[model samples]
Target: MVSFKKLTIRDILFRSRMAYYNRPSLAFVGQEPVTYADMAVIVRNVSGMLNTLGIGKGDKVALIGENSPNWGMAYLAITSMGAVVVPILPDFSGHEMESIINHSEAKVVFVSAKLYGQLDRKNIPGVIAYILINNLQPFDESVTTPTAGMPYETPKAIVNVDYCDCELPRPDEDDLAAIIYTSGTTGRPKGVMLTHKNLVSNVLSTLMIQEVNENDRLLSILPLSHTYECTIGFLIPMATGASVYYLDKPPTPAVLIPAMQAVKPTMLLSVPLVIEKIYKNKIKPELTSSSLKRKLYSFTPTRKLLHRIAAKKLHKTFGGELHFFGIGGAKLSFEAERFLNEGRFPYSIGYGMTETSPLLTGSSPKLVRFRTAGFSIPGQELKLLNPNPHTGEGEIIVRGANVMVGYYKDPELTQTMFIDGWLRTGDLGYIDSDGYVEIRGRSKNMILTASGENIYPEEIEDVINKHEFVLESLVYELRGKLVARVHLNKEALEKYYENLKHSAKDWQHNAEEHTRKVLDEIMNYVNAKVSKFSRLNHIVEQQEPFVKTPTQKIKRFLYKE
Candidate 1:
């Protein structure tokens, strides 16, 4: 019921900060949290400091960091003061970071201490200064900054602007708030331009599906740079007076389990891979550890019971208070979805991209279907273009208030993104009679078979990933034959060898033979589940896991044969 169409990012900040003035806003685990009152003053100080550095409205300010309270504060400070923020993912390689910096022509960079070394501003011009985010100190005195010393500590020229100050070219609902360069599967990093309204629209529409309030505690595991996290995980929490906790390190099990207990997060937003890994690597193995249990797990009624038992333990392991477990960025594996549905875990799958303000079609935990991405959000239109007659699948085109304005400065690329009036998602899906959206796969990832069958490799990959020994798998075409490169779990492979009697000369030979047999079994198992055209001809073992984008999506461009 909260209307935010006319509100800018700055307006949202002032409203929420004043309303929840003394409430905790952001914190690191086991550390003193920053209250809304504290964040307001900090954001104000940081904005005043940026202004002192000659940074003004429409100036590009870049931010790169691991997920932390400072990162969240910096984002607010940059956008609230009318400067466009360019958020670079922490996982971006040195070359990738340099490319983004050079392309964006950022006047100022606010980088965290951990990822500071990646910024090579050797010959890049127009860069005014690099400010360290943690302490807000001058990162580089060599740059042509307005002042040499700390402006955050003591600014030479400070313009104290009130929330209702009248000024020309000030932060507006239509003004460009952030330009996020997407590290997509296409290998082209294009800047996605989102306005204050674009982001706030998503935050408000998301609230329609789920409620976040002052009493809510959120454990943020995804990168703050990602729109999925930036809008839903960060902005949504800020708007509704919820508290968010971030981890200084990566979200490994050892680090997360303890943090979950400490924070007792009421809601968590994640990509499918994170929860899928938890289900695959931990819960499933523990439940079917014995032969008798495996037999019981094969039956539908008994499998549901086993999944329910494991899901209860899993819920407690995540601090026992998680209500809305929102998964997005990629499709949830059907096997994993069945587990969550049967186990009665409060999980919801969201489907969208950075260009759509990261949420176009999604459901709340209670409204979710087993494998559907639910209906379009409020104020959005979703329709299929050129849908197949039989399957009813086509490119999922959308037009919505939450959609990005366009790709930054690249008019050609921006023009190409939209067709007629709707933005071309390039995702293949269909709307069911009941209005549930089922995404088949990306249109680019679909393989056109010699027999003229449209095969989605992702669907096959999902089946392949369900195998116990298979950690992950990538399905691709090789010389007109479907082949999969599988990354096996070393421990699971070894366990297979331990449980079986193999005719091999030595331990090494036995392990190798057992691995080959296991991969073959996986291939056969996956083939049995898929249609004939989708069957994999060969299964090759990969020594290492496939390199992924920040959100754990496999960089398909890197593996193209």
Candidate 2:
């Protein structure tokens, strides 16, 4: 890891220019690259704009938008000028968005025009202004023009409103950097207050774990509003003088592939679902066209060749030097991880909840470990509380600088989260002798059988995830019987059945046969690998896919009876 013994966020940004001197720091779709020189100017412009608006030290501002260069600019502008930034997820529903705005008490809101309508001003307090990003609609006197430059001028009536050059306050490291709302799996969202020290320290610690340099170019697709991207993608890259690119539109294969190949990014931070979908839907069918290709893929010798081809193909997609491909936000299937590993692809598995500034553990290229999530990140503390001796598993507890200050303004709920100052991470997992952390499902998500056996649905789902035709699986007990609700891969199924000698009566018959075969294979494999208590009894197939979060994690509670 790079040493930042005396570095601050300001120092990190400025020092990188000295190191990488002439590199681009940011590139937006269809826009000119913002060089290190331009970065300084933009930051100052942001400071000037805030000063003009009477926003200063200790003020709270909310930035709500899709992942874009402007999003990063707004965040840095606010935090650098001694104000707290509240990053609202762009996909948040109208009610959730309103609740966060009211709770954060932000005096200014920077929102995308598409989502601006979702915010109701009734609950927001003293919001001096609303700045539209890329929208040209007329607003109140407080609506300001974008600092980078706007073709349209401020109306004469609002022209004299103050946009000043007041000095930016120099806040202490302990000052709040952001208040991020975590997508609660079982309850309403909580605003996790992360201080400047919390975010900067986490970025430094991550740099220590993974050695990224000034030349490293990163493709930023994860929501900047999320801690995962803010910490790893934005802050870390800026700290090291790496240029970050934001897509013009949503991240589909068509949009991402061109951006990736053009940028030839050195790094990519993403969820497992992205790669898993590509593998199951695109890669699997190509490899199983004939019995020989299928047999060859199953064999280690031939699998190595397949892996090389896959790595090369992926390399082409990412523009090479694709040294670090990180997967997080949810558990990945064994098959997907194995393919990447066997193909000699470099990737990392990270594990953390939003509360820890999200970097509790991760694996690097040199220290790759597939099954386990990896050792704790530098500087954080971890422990398991109330372990089950036999299984060596229990609730995961963490305490460190990276942990959020507290849930925003909800002292009662916040008090319950910290048991003797250690954050009660709802996850259940254990550490290995080598210090690696392997996470099981959530402690609250565990289902106990009538026979006095405790079973984890996520563990069974992980096993089922390995099947070729399965996209996602959710396991839960219904009427004393363990059942699995699964989503089949329609495209993969159609291709597989098309190759069959006998024509099926209908698509339903073909799907039933495929489902039965998959269930029998997965059941036999899991039953052999797991204890009888953990084995699933029956499987249910759905033509429709389960609704998922941005990270592709199935909202289990949404499908519950």
Candidate 1 lDDT, tens digit per residue, 1-561?
Answer: 555536588877888777899899988888878888778777777777787777889888999877878788888888998999999998898788877887888888887666766666785567887888666655554553332232222121233453224332459888999999987888888999999888998888878878888999999999899999999999998998899998866888899999999999899988888888888888888879999998999999999998898888889999999998999888888878999999999989988899988898888888998889988888788899999999899999999888889988799999998998899999999899988899999898899998889999988998998888888889888899999999988877666656776323555756666678778899889889999889999999988888887778898889877
lDDT of 2: 0.77
Check candidate 2 and list the clashing pairs: 1-208, 52-164
Task: Provide the lowest-lDDT 10-residue window in model 1.
Answer: 148-157
Question: Would you list the C-alpha lDDT of every candidate in the order shown?
Answer: 0.84, 0.77
Off by over 4 Å in 1: 141-169, 501-505, 510-513
Q: Can you give the lDDT of residue 296 in candidate 2?
A: 91
Can you list the residue pairs that collide in candidate 1? Answer: none
Listed in order, each prediction's TM-score against the native is 0.94, 0.90
| lDDT winner | 1
Kindly list the per-residue Cα lDDT of model 2 for residues 109-204, writing each as its tens digit. Answer: 887766776777776757887876543122563444234233311112122223433666765678887888867666467889888788888888
User: Residue 492 in candidate 1 has what lDDT?
Assistant: 73
TM-score of 2: 0.90
